[model samples]
Target: MTLKIPLENSSFNLDVSGIAGFFGGEESFAAMSSVHLVRGRRWLGWYNSPGSYYVAKKYGVLAKSRVWDGLYPGVNVDPTTMLELDGKVGPRYVAAHSGTRMEKTGHLAYLLASHYSDLEVDQVIPGPSAKSEAHITIASLEEFKEFEGYPKLPADHLSPFDPIATVPIAFSVGASVMCAIFGDWYCFAMIILGVVCNGVSCFVIGSGVLKIKQPNPSPHSPPGDGVLFNAPGSRVILLKGSEKIISSITRGRFFLEYKSQSQYHDIGYSSVALTMQFLLQLFIVPQGQLFGQIMFLSSLGVSWIFNAYLASVDREDLQKRILMRVLLQKPTFRTVALPKWTSLVVFAAVYLQAKPEGTRGLLEQLIPNDTAVWRLVKSAVVEAVERNKDPSEVVAERNLDHLDNQERGLLEDMMKQASIGYNAGNDFKL
Candidate 1:
């Protein structure tokens, strides 16, 4: 039986309307495997395939259907692959892609970045390309999703099981997130394997699309120079009628990089650790309990790695940007267009909410085994800045120096720095 996707989103009413305009023809995704593509109007816009559109949305790209031509081979992009923003959306951040002002998916990217995001975000970067200029900032994830034309989500955004390749990786990421919150190493391991499996999925998807060769080349539309139509030994980056070809290559690169980032998050111990985690979870005895921990740890590690890697891709959030901005003055984390820090806090908080098991597990680590009230004092010191006192003044008033000798002492320096903006939240922007 074919799957049916429901429409619950009125959020992107404008975008849906735009889509409806071209949806003169109803298309049945009876053959389409991805749930996001179940049954929707077919149009020239978005992706030609329902699966592609579904995957794009899952990866946090709302307008990804339109931005990417189709699932092409050799392209390395993923949802985790971040888009680094340079300027502003309207009066805020400017956007660019492939050296051009982002017209496609710009709004979608902007909206995603603005909503459901984390970090002291500065910019949003599109995936796979290492090119520095290919990024833009829209707003924090929270505000972006609520933007004027954002689309409504269907039951928190899900993809159907098919094309086995992507399923594992996507599941890995999703599961890893659960692991982090639940401290399940086995689940985490599953996440690692799943991510690699996703790379394989990308390959399958790319290859499948790549095979759609035309019987006879149209002599009229001479192919442009790109990776699309390389006649095996040809040197010219021949761009051809292979919109599908370019898309395949694009798809390959995307998954490749996404896999690479997974490894990168693994810090070059890489997929090797993933293999190890999978082995441990699979072979180790107690089966259920430890296996779950393995999964959680694996997932947590990967998820954190994604965040840290994104911090690199979105270098504005990297140490360089954070430090430079901190050096010049106080740092006010910018969330594309909306209130800064809102996204970062919300992202972390939401993740915490989603994985209550993991969040509770992490609480044990956060709590000092020895002292409780002192950690409380440090918190008080951190909050003091909000009281509008200077960092020094706040520390002194709270007698936080007493914390110097306390067990949580090391946190003092971190608090001191963060406290600089204790009173500056309203003033800072990325």
Candidate 2:
């Protein structure tokens, strides 16, 4: 009597639009499977052949249709001989001879048949074998299905601020501000105390936030009982356990140390800003002079703005590093692009702030003379500057290249410095 097994129907249907884009186009999508609709292509071709349908119905739990293409080329092996062949022939040879391409049904049948026939089937599966190496058995099909989804993505969370550490730091900042306003010698003492507390808090918070701990594997069990075969040649066995643990731990340690140092620099810069503000208010602003007061306030505002800019730049640098790491690990669906509107706004601001020669040079390098956006920004800035200046102070057209050589040389030096900085090592110093 031929034994028959029922096919498990899928609870979820494939997202056709998403799948179509993923494979390149509708034609590529249609080429995926033999089944085609009048309007759209079928996701899986299992229904095209009775044998394929039967195998998919019976062993769908072993793999999903989307992932079947990857598995189909390597499904002919008897599980019992997989390890032996793998050790002698090497992985490339074993993978090459595993099966014929596009044989979805045959692959499913091979997987199901191998699982039932071989007692040590778990040891010889083509995919990940770390848990199997550790003698970890799936308690149910549900547990195995959990591991079969799309690749696990990294978490999006990035900030490492700890509220507990932040509270004390906030208190220190407040105390330092109060002391500075009163012009007390105790302000120096408070500043010193705040710096020390800032360092300790940053280290403690960063370590907690980025901690990495690996789970200990189960102790070895007797062979042929609960144990899977101990194949030292398996990639997972050699690299997944202790090696992964060590690497993660090292990475976490380095991140924490780096973040702590950045925080220290941030605190030191804030201290400098506070000192400048205090000195300006206490000694530079004369009691009766409006100009002295305006100058003092301007200096204080500029110092604070510079400090804030440095902190923001550091954060952006860190975010870029994180994004690079993530992209290295996963396939990206689209290239990142800067919005045109943002570019325009930033260009307008830069042009308004820059010296005319410097602005003109930047425009020459950044945009063609005929570009509409550049023209708009340049005309607006030039009109505003001319409107504010006295007619007598307005420079003649001949001085349009004012400080031309010096500004161009300065701009080139700045560009060179930026290029060097970007190409330098990832280590960011304040």
Candidate 3:
């Protein structure tokens, strides 16, 4: 005999709105499960199969439908995955699953049946009621307090006074002012050199400096409060470990400062050499001599070698190595060790090329000091003038008499062609 049950029964309804979007269409949602409005509050949840309702009911966790909108309930949603619960339903509420929110039963039974089997279902128990616990809507459970809004991006930093850039600019402007006052191209070259050097140095050095250091978490500071740095590749900030940071920062300062000083030295050397060349051309060097030009240009070359030697010293900075890795855009090997053993060879070469060989004055180094030979040449020229003969011809006959026949013939031919060309140029001018 079948026992007749009353219309009023222990039941609840579970809404499956959250999982509705996942279905391809209403047919898919309807095919998955059926939801019907029963007469009383009954268990309403999605099930994998038609028989899952009996399994859930046997474990005391109800999946059987109660009522929805006071209509006969039918299968409409299946047990997919429980997302979360929404607003309250009547006076009592049950745990949600497969994006299902049930009302009436106040315990989490769907989570148990899904997670644990019948043997382990006893271990599962209900947690604090949703109404009893405080709620927080946060993006992340970790570090919830610190996140206020969208994080601010790091800003580009610029020093109030950069000696490397400022010094060169000052010199260039000074040269411009001097050019305006003195009205000479020498000053213009000086100014142009300064400006060019400044631009080049900025490109090379400033590029490295411009990449800002990312905020690294400090060991000493509270978690989430990152370590700060004054500039990219700089360790001016005293981090937790003092000894290491100090040494690293000192080395970085030395490397960048050494570079700046070397550039300044180049600018000063060029400016001074140009100024001296200008003065010598006006008062001492009657014409630009090939030997004089060679010696002067060689000195500048040696100065460049000296600058290279100064820069070649290995000064390692930890901060700079990290910055280099970031700028490369991918993980790379650590800073390659500089071959400092070759520094001795560079030093010797620089010294040999730059050092003066003998007790030669500055002017004598550039110009020949053969006073007696010049005087003899002058006497030969005077005798030729008195005898009404060409000075060049007389000089060659007297001073160059020891030359062989072939050498004499070659010299005479060169002189004849040079004289003819000079005459032609003079005629053209006239």
The lDDT values for all models are 0.28, 0.25, 0.24
- Against the correct fold, how does model 2 do in TM-score? 0.18
lDDT of 3 by residue, 276-356 (tens): 333333333222232332222232233223223323322122222322222212221111111121111111111112122
**What ranges in model 1 sit over 4 Å off?**
1-31, 34-378, 381-386, 400-411, 420-426
Candidates in order, TM-scores: namely: 0.22, 0.18, 0.17
* lDDT tens readout by residue for model 1, 7-54: 222232211111211121112112211212211211111111112222
Per-residue lDDT tens digits for candidate 2, residues 313-363, read 333233333323432221111111111222322222232333444334333
Prediction-by-prediction clash tally: 83, 1, 29
**Candidate numbers sorted by TM-score from highest down:** 1, 2, 3
Ranked by lDDT, the better of candidates 2 and 3 is 2
Worst-scoring 10-residue span by lDDT in model 1: 91-100
